[model samples]
Target: MKFTPVSGSSALIGAVLALVSSTSNAADLAAAEARARGHIAAESARTMHDAQHSYAARDVIIDDDGTEHVRFDRQYKGLRVIGGDLVVHSHADGRFKGNSQTLAKSLRLSTQHKIKASEARAAAVAAHGGEAQKVSEKVIYARGDSPVLAWEVRVNKAQADGTPSELHVIVDAASGAVLESWDDIHTAAANGTGTGYFSGNVALTTDLVSGTYYLRDPSRGNTYTTNMSNGTTGNGTVFTDADNVWANGLLSNTATIGVDAQYGTAVTWDYYKNVHGRNGIANNGVGAYNRVHYSSGYNNAYWSDTCFCMTYGDGDGTTFNPFDSLDVAGHEMTHGVTSRTANLTYSGQSGGLNEATSDIFGTMVEYYAANANDAPDYKIGEKLYKSGTGALRYMYSPNLDGSSADCYYSTIANLDVHYSSGVANHFFFLLAEGTAGAGMPTSKTCITGNKLKATGTASLTGIGRSPAAKIWYRALTVYMTSSTTFKGARTATLKAATDLYGTGSTQYNAVAAAWSAVLVN
Candidate 1:
């Protein structure tokens, strides 16, 4: 994704380049910024009746052709509007061209509150199926034929399954109607240690803050780990010790699991930096923190974009060990990366791509680490199984798991994202390793119960992991967009392969063949 500098516009090019260079800070888009504000004011007058409705510039991008795109965050009555964001496109002469908005209609709503804030909080808690531990309310523009005055109530509590909860509920301020609700916790029902369940015996990196050493890596953006102390929520205590050495084989010694988590985090960090040129999860050069032993007998781990952190569970300690295995950590952390980048929504086919992206990188990270005890394989959560004989997902043959779809179909979009992820997962395996019987892994078969074969008469040849991973990473970061579908993914990967290996090259052909093999065409 290289952009050529426009000749005679070195100053403007430098400004645009600076804006696109770092994801850490907002770009100082001076020229575009000024035009964007005026555009917003004019649009606000036409769309929103009240003077209270306004917009603040969130991002500005100036294309090489002299077009400017300004993204704005909307506010109503000085309060943030949840889904009122829009993007304004302008020409170089500061002339308004067009705008894209999430809102379906104009913002005109009654500001008078018929429902008390306390009542709205209670309604939110009731909708969340739990007692409210904490609740916050704000005015928001609720989407409909006409935007309506709504109280956006956020409730935090424990779920029925003992998982920590963060639910957002929208209640109509005048009618006290529950307009919408959503859970913030992203859990994938599935870590660490003095002796990690999979990493075997390992040494850990620590930060010596004061006289005590803590489970913090000073090298990787000061990445740190903490013990959740078997609770579901809140920032856990940072693991500290008089001696730098921590974690033993005993499951009782939770610090041992922290060792596995910390090690996994380090390896994942290294994989992104060394392979994909990503500095960290958000490409901000700042590391994310980890929390282990979340909740008693918790069976799932999750990544929270709100906190910019990852959480691991101890499992039931029977059916599963800790959820801090290297691949698991990679999987979870990749979720954060996806959120920061192509943020594929967590449902339907896009969600499947989201999960497959994580799974793909998770496998790559595992192989990159090359840990002897946890031999790398195209299997997700292979180490988390209590029996230690089965895997949660099989990339070589997704149907072996009995839930994941091995090939694409019209109905594949209807399956759960985790299950639908099989399509891309299998495509990736085929792209990297070719067919199972054709000289890659053993005992691999296609969704049709036949030997996996390439599309058309072209015989599939292995392109190896490095090229495949690079292609996928490039597609993910450069070509993929928020609403990219499987078909769009095919286009993205093809473009990526072309960029990396050139058009009509062996790698490019392999990418096309792989997608066809998975029935993505």
Candidate 2:
């Protein structure tokens, strides 16, 4: 979002002054030259607003020429600014004036720029050692820095028997950068709607399906497996053309991983929209980019602020496909959402809380999607493991999984962020359910002690997950911050519940007892 200063004759002059102000006090010619370039760039956008859907521009910094500038390998085709004007500073030309119009549209700036998403995708695929013509096209949406455009394409290469081979490309529209690709040949034909990327292979009827997902590229073959390793069912790798790669190695082959990834994303989008009235992650009704089969044998998934996209990878086949699970997708994508909003740090106790917040929302999305492929459980990393016998992390008893800590302590930060997340997880469970021991309820329960157990401890039962989740969300958004700790979380939730339900109310008092049971002062 660009911020355009008020425009008038004087405003134009003021913009020029702002441009010149970039380096007025520079002592050296080198510094002056650097500021000149910086001023021009800032001045270029000074009078323009609504660049890339109102992405505000601030803290303009200019680098000195001869400062060893680095450029991306792919060349820029053109500059397209949406919702505002793009002011170009022509180096090779006769005199140009303010708001000048040229005979060459390509040379001049326009309100919005339209590019061939398919063409750019093909170029990126070819750059990555794949044929462009044989690939089928899908969604082409705008993405991160340099105003990138992302396109999906499926490969149509035939084998020796004239059978179609699997391949897919996610190309960058502006620089034609092959951002990522996937491959795994599924026999299912493409479903006609919104590019048919993963719609055919994975069922969306709210039941979760698990299988091996694969991606093919001329460079190499990448495969990943989901939680289902029974060998009878196969997701057939919906993309058939995209590859999965992680920092560790090749992830197991699992079908419907893409569908799972997309499903998780859809659920998250809907949860925020229907539950919180948010349009998308940024609350702008814009779709975010998602990449499945990120790396070979990749054991983890991540949300990248740089690319503004979410990536998933298959897990160890025997344990899980970290990408195919709904909670995992929601967890990673929530990192993106959190970054856009609270921008939580991934370190120390606050970091543990950050991770736990993702788990909280992630698990919520799972239940929201409520697919049959995987039953929604109040656990964070559970579905990623193929064992199916054990959960990755549990909210009720996080320590049971062997990774998470059961209780919060000052030293919680010393534990792995994933493992340390237990404290907050447990806190949330207690907040929602309270302290009840005998029955081992599907959800946790709380025992509220009023007046030293004179009435045999009046146990305040929970009002189910619906209202509980709202309290947690409100606390996270309105009260919690980067420095929030376990105790802070306790206070935040109690405050949120009291604000929403009223003080001394059963809901508010139950929330208070839940925190006390968790040992949060």
**Which candidate should be chosen as best, given TM-score against the real structure?**
1
Clashes of 1: 10
For candidate 1, the per-residue lDDT at 272 reads: 97
Best by lDDT: 1
lDDT of each: 0.72, 0.48
lDDT string, candidate 1, 190-304, tens digits: 5211222557777677889779998888889889998989876588999998988786767778787888888989999999988876778876678999999888888777878
TM-score of 2: 0.51
Clashes in model 1: which pairs?
191-322, 191-323, 191-324, 192-257, 193-256, 193-257, 193-260, 194-247, 194-256, 194-257
TM per candidate: 0.72, 0.51
C-alpha lDDT (0 to 100) for residue 493 of candidate 2: 79
TM-score of 1: 0.72
